[model samples]
Target: MLSICARHCVLWSIGRCANGCRTRTSHSSPRFPKSRSPTALPPMLKPSVRSAHSREYLGTWGISNGAQPGLFTGTCEGPRCDASGPEKGYTPHARVQQGFLRLLVRAQSALVQRSHHKRRNCAISGARFKRAREVVMASYIKRTIRLNPSQARTLSGFANRRGLSEYALLLKVIDAGFLALLHGTDRETDLAEMASVIGSISERLAERGTSREEASAAEKQIAALDTREAKSHADHKSLRADWRATAEAKGFGEAAQARAIAEAKERARAGELAASPEILAARAVAWAAAKLSERQAVFPASTLAREAGDYAFGRLSHNAISAAIAEAGERGALVPRAYLDRRGAESAGFTTPEAIATEQAMLRLEAAGRGVSVPLASSLAAARTVERAARQSARAGFAWTDDQKRATSALLTSRDRVAAVQGYAGTAKTTTVLATYAREAAKSGLTVTALAPTASAATVLGEALGLRGDTVARHLVSPEAKGLGKGAVWIVDEASMLSARDMAALMASADKAGARLVLVGDVRQLGSVGAGAAFAQLQQAGMATAKLANVVRQTNADTREAVMASIEGHAGKALAALERGGGDVIEGASRDARLATMAQRYVALSPTERVRTLVIEPSRDGRDTLTAMIRQQLVQRGELSSAAVRFEALEAKGLTRAETRQAASYAIGDVVRFARDYADKGVTRGSAYRVERIDPDKAAVALKAADGSSVDWRLRQWGAGKVEVFEC
Candidate 1:
């Protein structure tokens, strides 16, 4: 039985087992066959027990490793050779079959282990694996959004026409959205509003020609929105207050109380403080604090109200003043109780001890040369020396009238470091006061530089003094100007027109050079154009000023009296004086009729007389109309060419089709006026240009200056709000 089993085992290993296996060569690997009809032997060859050789074959396959255990073994003599396992005795063939099944299980597990080891050894590192995962995720990261059907269709069409992909079009939209948000505004709403404004402006430009009306309308719209929103916020605050009162009545937290107070402040900011006594008082204190300064620090109730404007002053009743005083009295530092009286008048102003000390310290530093500025000098004796020198120079150089001598003597004898020659128009300030000062300073071995805020003023002064004068920005305050000697004198004309900051800078510059500054202007004409009312402030601060009430420029007595009355702010007297000068008020039924009559009168004059005549109008629009009429009349008289184009002033927003058309109409050899100064090119505000070339596509308008130099500028540039290019 063992011999037969061993042969059968050999046959099975080589794929030729007689039981059911098909035979193959020894060199060939063995495999179990599915069909056994052609290879199966009859049941006679089937062993019941005693298949020793098969057990040996099983051992070779590692089935013998479990022989000593309770597992299956290929021996019929063992009690474990039963069908259940080696626990019960089994047939030899059955035992061999169990060993073969175990061998197949072991082979499968080994194959799984080998494959797992290969996977572990060839696995990716953490970083490399993460990078690979990111690459895969990046391919799917793009978001897909649905657009409205019509919008999608239109966008697709536009993209196709522009040779751009749908994705590229989306990117373009995103870029525009980013720019709108860059200014820290609401992107969607702001962009939409701006687009609407632009569309309206463009349509208006196309239809009626460009004007400032559209820009004004846009500003009004924005203002209206702000007002509406403020009202809404105020309403919300009132509603919140009602809820907050109830919350506090119940046992609410500190946060709720804090929120209530914050909402109240917001309501005040929205101008909803009419019913709130606390907010009104707080507002008064804040307003007074802002207006307080060392120059004019005290505040009487009436004066404070006047500074607050007519609208606010009208709102301030006795009750309002009482409420403000009551609240301000609670805070001694900001609004001191000592400052407020029973009548609600604040004698001093809302200021702290620290602030007062700081101001005093600054004044001390200024006297010490650390913060020396434009005002009266620290030394009275030094100022007297400078004044004496000016007087001596004037006396030795030229003969003068009694009034001129008096004015010259007054300026020279002034004790204030910053002296003003307060003279009205036609007072011979340029010829008498300024000229004498310049000549006197020069004779005293002092460098006298005449300066004015504007080029025209400087030129007038320069021509009158026979010494070239420059704008204050160019000569005194300019960084490029050489340092002045100790005895240098700056004769500043039109000194009243300077803003506070410019005045301060001028003073600081003068102080640095240890120079004497003589400010010359008519204070009664107009105050500073910008801010702080420097001339007025200094005059009020007790600076020495020479008053020149006598008029010398106007030869006619009636004209002189009219000028004097106007300068003194006597309206009725000024009108009477004008009537005395044979100046009558003219009235016409319409502006057009008045313009027509004026044109006829101008045309009736001889060419020489007409050239000397000047027409002045109160309004810019009126001036433009009169200019057009005068130009048309000049053309009729052959004084001007018909080819001259009337270029309208550009509005603040942007250029319109009408302006572009006017600019493009200029041709070669046409002369045009530069409406603004281009200082870098030495072209003044009213410089003339002769057009040499024109390119409409590039918006280029090439011009040759009077000096024969040529430069090209864009038509749009020439039509900026600050500039206008009119055919000359």
Candidate 2:
């Protein structure tokens, strides 16, 4: 038989030997709702005694060690507990003095012993007292057939060196176990888990303490989560109710649902709806927050939105607010736009506004630093759909179309001469074209023809169609567009920079296929890489004479001022005019700065002059800088014997694609951050190439990793950023 633990702290159980734990049938009544028949019950326990917590000698006495409410009862035993009351031969009660005197005498005896043998434990103590003290300790420690003398010698050696007795080890275990219980876990398990977490925390301490900028805020947030306050919850709820009541009284009917409608009406009433200076500041803050989040410094929108887009006093338009994103992107402004979305959502996705701005910065960095050609691309969507093609097709739900009722179905369905749509930046033009394409394409069951100015631009078009192109197209005349059958509608995107020749060629191609045409693009985006040969078709057509001047992108004076400078050929005066007044070069768009941004410049320049002077672009790389970096990384990793990888970083404002391709370079295992995406493909952690096989504009780098692997990646389509050849 083995003795196991009982109700007492002392081990006091008798159990069957060899293994552990025992099972016993309980005799308690069944605990379900009662049935009428007692015969339904199976069996009854033989009459026998049972312990409250155990079967025979194995009782659950240790449960009181924890004693959760309703689980078990506490017993007055173990340490700190004394005999309950005097009984038998002892008196039932004692006078207070008697108790005190007894305690006093015990203390007096301990004091005498301490005084007499205090030095006995010390080395070389006086002979008489040393011997006496040893005798006293030994008498209490008396044992028979215990540890042998030789074993005792080893114990004595340990006690002498550490100055700790065997009892001390027992004390340490109890202390650790008690602490584990307090932390809401089983003693043994909690102790192990806490040790593991603490070890990891110690390792990461250096990283967490790397910055102190938001130290207080982080601490406050942690504290807030750790403790709750009921008062604030009540206050915010009360405030919501009041705001609702006030809005209803004012006929606003709770948070204006249609901002566009409301804005139009307000501006109509005043003849102009310019936002106040404070509103202007708030809008800037919102814009910045969005930009930051795109770059992955994601923040909360409640921190910024109410302050953005000053409509009444500052002349901020909804479109203008959106355009600022492009301006920020171009300027390398890092704002977390994710934090400034409608309804103040803090979702994971970076809307077009935030993403465009961050990518602008990243694109600039890749061009200037690594000599990589990065395009500032976004899933940019425009609000109003284009009506040219859609309106012609009655089934697509266009509001109106030209009255050609007397003409045949040909006039209502397709046109002989192609139509062109052009605009820059904003004006809700591109969006219009895309919407028209989607609707008309859906209606006709005919493949729509599309064109782009460059391979990258073509890819952009393909993205709009949920497809990735097989080959990069330099002009709309590429073979990819020939698939359109007769009676189809052709959509030429980014049509502004497109030559009238390519448009003419595409029109011929479309005509051959019996397809109607609607050409769309941003004229401000540019038609050529400053190439004389490239613009000949456009120059011959003289379509540059057609212009849409009601500037839809910027309704705010300051935003318009900024965009004026941002568009390729119109920025110099915008910047100079802005600088002449309150525009804070330091804070960018503080109140004074915004005011200054609205000023007029002494002289205005042509589009060419403005782009040349105001735009601070470095010459595009003659060779691929980023490709070189990748090749170098490959060489370092022993993956390549390269044509070479070059590392270049630029701060250019208008870096060119031609120059980027000219300087293009790469290596294996090179990490890149896509200027267009900060995450999703923001961090390109892999690239490696085997040197002998690749073209100048492209690299045949080995695909070194799988998706989300975090290391060694290869890409089919890529852009470059500040190249780090050796380290990336």
Candidate 3:
């Protein structure tokens, strides 16, 4: 079978030799037919049968079988086949044929195995290549897009504005556009649904009529109800009073009559007889009138309204109070007036006729003092000479500017009994200008007396002017004021702090003594705490005023500019200047944190800088917080002593007169400062004493002085504005 198969293979090879040779045979194999050449061969045998060795073997078989030999001999010549064949003289035996057949079978089997391995390897390689291609494609895809000139310019402009490259900007635009596309459908759907809902709601509202008309009708109904309620409440009160009177007149016992009245009142309350707007308004008006009478001065309408609301247990509104006030004014029950408040803004309030009369008297006194003029002790020429001489003889290294010289000359030449010198802060008002004026006045043989609203201010003024100092309160009641006759110049520093009443008294005293009154201070620094802007008012009233305009204290130009701007009421500009000048503007996540940072920075400053620093806190609570924080920092840095002393100190309670009259308000260990002298009780004005004992039964309080002396003070004498109480 092997030989026959080999013979068939040889026959097939010989039939289709590359040399155009053929073999004829009567018998044919099924794979190679008798009348056709072997054009197609099996896949396994194609390589082996096409090789030179196979061709040589076939040639040997063909020759041995008496067929052509050269047909297969030179057929396998090319790069695809080795030219070498079986060695010369080699016999084509049966064993050799069998070995060649086995070799061919083994080669076919190996080829089959290699083909399978290649197919498997190709599948794996194709999968990996596909994955790598997918990743590369996903990472980035370069695409060419066509754009019009306008679109290109717009894109370039957008990229420039965004500080991005054109490529990057385009990518961002594509990403944003994709996101917008994804969300656009949802947004449109939402809008359509909203429109549908709105349409439905509009139809519903239309069916119910217009909303504005309904609201107006509801308001009218409410107003009518309020009016009816007020009338019902008044009628119920009258009916209850009439029933009580009838019951008492019908010989009912006291208890029975009281019970009847109580039951009637209860029934009225249980019904719709609640107090209405009119009643509340009337109560608010009455309360405000009482407050005006008690304070004996005009207070802010808004403040009074808030107080009235509290008094009425939140029954009164501000509008109700205002309306009541207007009605009372119309009926001559109250007087409505407007005055310039501390901030130089007009404020409206209700005042009593008596209070108005008092204010008129104060104005008249101011006018009278202005009318009285004081002749200078010397001629104008002599005063000018004296001023020039004083300026020339100023302390070493101290030179007066033109503004200071002018201010001094004005003060010296002024003949008005009440004169004013308006100077801003840091203008050397007291140290240079006023000092020069005082020296010139002294040289002119006029006695200059220094006075201020506060003792510390007076001390500063006296030290600057080289004279004795005294507080305005003390000076007013002292014998020195009585002797202030002609040739005396009374210099009042910090005169802006003087209330209208105090100014009137001081002017009257100066006028009567024929003394020239000099009012020196900055109106913008701090205004009068009591009732009036007398300093600014006097200037506005056409009184002779000498204004010191040049600021000399601040040497830094930026700081000076800021101060000038603030003085001129340019707060925003002043703040900007301060920032530009490197001012410490501490800011933090919270107010406490900012304050803590400020305290830390303050502690970091040198001792000299700390002494020069001025911290202005608008509220007492804030001031206390800042002070505590600063002290804590100082202690931590060993700049301040860690030890502390606790004692009773007077802090103004700012209570009302009625609140202060209750003896229960007086607590032991609390300190009180007398605003007026109580000589009989050994308590002097402006003196603070601790309350050693409080006796509510006797309506008296025993106060111990700082010197260990005790005095009994009547509780009634501790009214508001007379004595300030401080909790220990």
lDDT of 2 by residue, 286-380 (tens): 44453333232344443323224422234556555556544544555533334434345465322334344333442332223221211111122
- State each model's CA lDDT, in order: 0.49, 0.34, 0.58
Q: Give the C-alpha miss distance for residue 703 in model 2, angstroms.
A: 22
- Candidate 2's C-alpha lDDT? 0.34
Candidate 3: segments with Cα more than 4 A from true spot: 1-298, 311-333, 339-348, 351-355, 369-374, 377-383, 386-395, 638-641, 656-659, 662-670, 673-721
Encode model 3's per-residue lDDT on 449-493: one tens digit a residue. 999999999998898888889999999998878886787889999
| Residue-level lDDT tens digits of model 1 in 648-724 | 44323222233333344556666656567877655677666777888754456777888887766665444333444
Stretches of candidate 1 above 4 Å error?
1-401, 413-416, 480-482, 570-576, 645-728
Give RMSD to native, each candidate: 30.4, 32.8, 43.0
**TM-score for each of the candidates:** 0.40, 0.25, 0.53
Q: Estimate the TM-score for candidate 2.
A: 0.25
